[model samples]
Target: MKIAVMGAGALGGYFGGRLAAAGQEVTLIARGAHLAAIRERGLKILSPRGNLHVPAIPATDDPATVGPVDVIMFMVKNYDVESGARAIAPMLGPETMVVTCQNGVSAHERLGAIIGAGRVVPGVARIPADVPEPGVINHSAMWDTLVFGEADGQVTARVEGFRDAIVAAGATAVLPGNILHDLWRKFVSQATLASMTALTRLDLGPLRTNPDSRALFTAAMEETERVGRVAVPDLPGELVRKEWEILETLPDTMHASMLDDLNAGKRLEVDYLSGDVVRLGRKHGVPTPIHEVFLAALRPFKDGDPAGLAKDAVQEFRTRT
Candidate 1:
């Protein structure tokens, strides 16, 4: 299969590199020093499963450079969904499939609005990886899985073929009975972890170990489940408990990507994670006080700390004078 990995940071780099190693014709779309490093020294994957170095993977910053592809792995940050979709428009063919492996639930719909819904496939990424430096991906966890399916829940040939390609690349891939439900399940846990970790400025070990923090985490997840049930009525009522169970199984050092962004002084995805929960809660008439606090506290850092802090400092000096 010919695949294009749009936004070749962390998640995209690791998975796309693995697929290329498995004999798929893969091209990575990236920018800045990372793109330059990939072009010069190739992409490197350091993982507990195994270390891989694809010395000559094709990579470029512009999607137009690599014409139409069989599959486009749309893995940009949640905020970049619309622009990324527009950027990749020139690479879409009649039979091309664009699979979104983003955090929030609205990515597929946002992409579907630009490109046709038929061309978009909803997917969930279960790997914990990060780009420690340019062109180098550090995969921490052992479980690497990609679960995706058609928007209409059909077991189509394209879906099956993509699953085969992913599995052959040595990653777990599956077509769930209901892809929307799976997305919601992922959101329930992700929003909870991202909110608590970012707000408290701690990792899962500290958050899950303390009784008060754990209760807050549980409440946030419960609120997300309440909103999810109204938005997706078919969602199981026991989803909150199931998510808590999954949370307990995670390694103590685990933390959400939003926390990583916060530590790096980069823009936060709180709007899409916890903020999405707050938005849906309003739409469904569900109360989400916990998530509301999460959004309010994190909104200042949503666009990163630069503009907001500079503006605040100027205002303070003027007021004192």
Candidate 2:
């Protein structure tokens, strides 16, 4: 079970570090100060489930330095998808399973172009986390897990072997029944939260508790679901309705990774999540006024605004995490 985790940030750092600690052979591709810290002090995982220090994790700046691998866990943000794909070419063997644990639905398609669809697997990451600072990942929730499967739903040797390897790493992993649907459902959830949170400058807590904000959140979800159904017409409407109920239970303080990225002034995945929703809505002639408005309001903060959101005004529309 030789695993290569490309993009060793929050999600990659947590999963890859845990796998390496549990004795799975994991190679992480990272760079800059975060990479230096991992190499110097090992990976510091500040997780509620438990803390771990992966003292001997293997990492490098270039995939060529590591050579071909068995499982390639793709964790790059949408902004880097294309370049990340090109970078991974040297590490991929013919049979390697490149699992994408990124947001939205198009990551597999983009990676497939780079590494061929036969070798691509789409993965969904369920984790509430962020990199509070370089080399330190603040995982507020402990339920981080990874689910991925073959594009054709065929339990090939590669898929099965990655499951076994992830389990051996003391981590929760599964090959889902309908991987595409899983990917979309995650999109519906994330787009709603990310757009709502970033647009309102409100975290999950405030967004869910206030009736006005909560209804607005539902509107955003409906917009995402409408566009998704148009793009993937076979998706069930009832499933999305029921899924909305499931989302209600999420802690109000919870925020999407995109919101955290926006707060940090880093390049965002806007083009994929909220931006993609708007794009598909236009492509399929679905009206997405709510999400469009959200995108319009938040796009400004991504580049020039460097202050932590204004507190008094934000508190009027925000709730504490």
Candidate 3:
């Protein structure tokens, strides 16, 4: 199948490169120096499992120049959500499937507004990946497991085709019966960790090891899980506990992509993740003091000193709660 990766950053590069390596017709939409590098030297993937340099893959910055493809892995950053979606809309054919491998709860809906709901698939990616350098993706420590499903929870040919393609690309695919539930479950797990690590300026390895920090992390997780439950009532209550325990088992140095964005001075996903928690809380009349506070603290860094922003956020969270 012809697959076009919209972002081509760490997440897109890792997954798209894998597909390209497996002989799929993959095109990476990129810009500036990264686009140049990929065009000149091929797409380079430095994964924990291995490494590769895709020599003949197509890389471009303009989506209009590229024709419609069978699938599009929409992996753009949170900041470029709409713009990216808009840019890729013209490239989608009637039968094209656009998979959103992004953070936040309503990504599928948000993109659906621009690309039509029938062609949208909500996806949740579980991996630590980022572009350590332009044209180079560093696949960090985590299983390259992906879960996605059709918007209406109906298993369709497009969904199954995506599953087969992903598996052929050498990653795990979770074809959940209910994609929304699966996506929300991952959001609960990721939102808690991203906020805690970015705020504390510590990796999960150290943060989970500290008594006070661990407690705070758990509290945040508990609060987020509470918010998620109210937002998604169908989610079982005990699932949060399992999510927490599973997170505890990951490598301590594990930092959410938000933390990486914080350190790099790039825009963070606080608004969609924890910030969404606060928004939903207000909508449901649920008290979300923790999430609200974290949003306030992280706002300063989301723009400029996001690294220091996270530090201050943690300190303030520690002091207040």
Model 1 lDDT-worst window of ten: 306-315
Off by over 4 Å in 2: 301-321
* Greater-lDDT candidate between 1 and 2: 1
Query: Which TM-score value belongs to model 3?
Result: 0.92
Q: Please write out the lDDT profile of model 2 over residues 80-159, one tens digit for every residue.
A: 88999999988888778899988888889988987788888999988777777667777777587789998877787778
Global lDDT of each candidate? 0.91, 0.80, 0.82
Residue-by-residue lDDT tens digits, candidate 1, 43-105: 999999899999999999999999999999999999899899999998999899999999978
For model 3, what is the error of residue 75's alpha carbon versus the real structure, in angstroms, after optimal superposition?
0.2
TM-score, candidate number 1: 0.95
Q: Which residue pairs show backbone clashes in model 2?
A: 204-252, 205-252, 205-253
Backbone clash count, each prediction separately: 0, 3, 2
Range of the 10 consecutive residues with the lowest summed lDDT in candidate 2: 304-313
**Alpha-carbon TM-score of each model against the true structure:** 0.95, 0.90, 0.92
Measured over all alpha carbons after superposition, the RMSD of each candidate to the real structure, in angstroms, is: 4.4, 3.1, 4.0
Candidate 3 structure quality by residue, lDDT tens digits, 1-321: 999999988888888899999999999998888899998889888877788889878999999988999999999877678899889966888889899988978777888888788888999888877777888988876488888998678888888988998898887787898877777777776877888888876788888778888787777777777777777788766767778777867876788878767866677788888888888889888888888888988877666563464456656867998
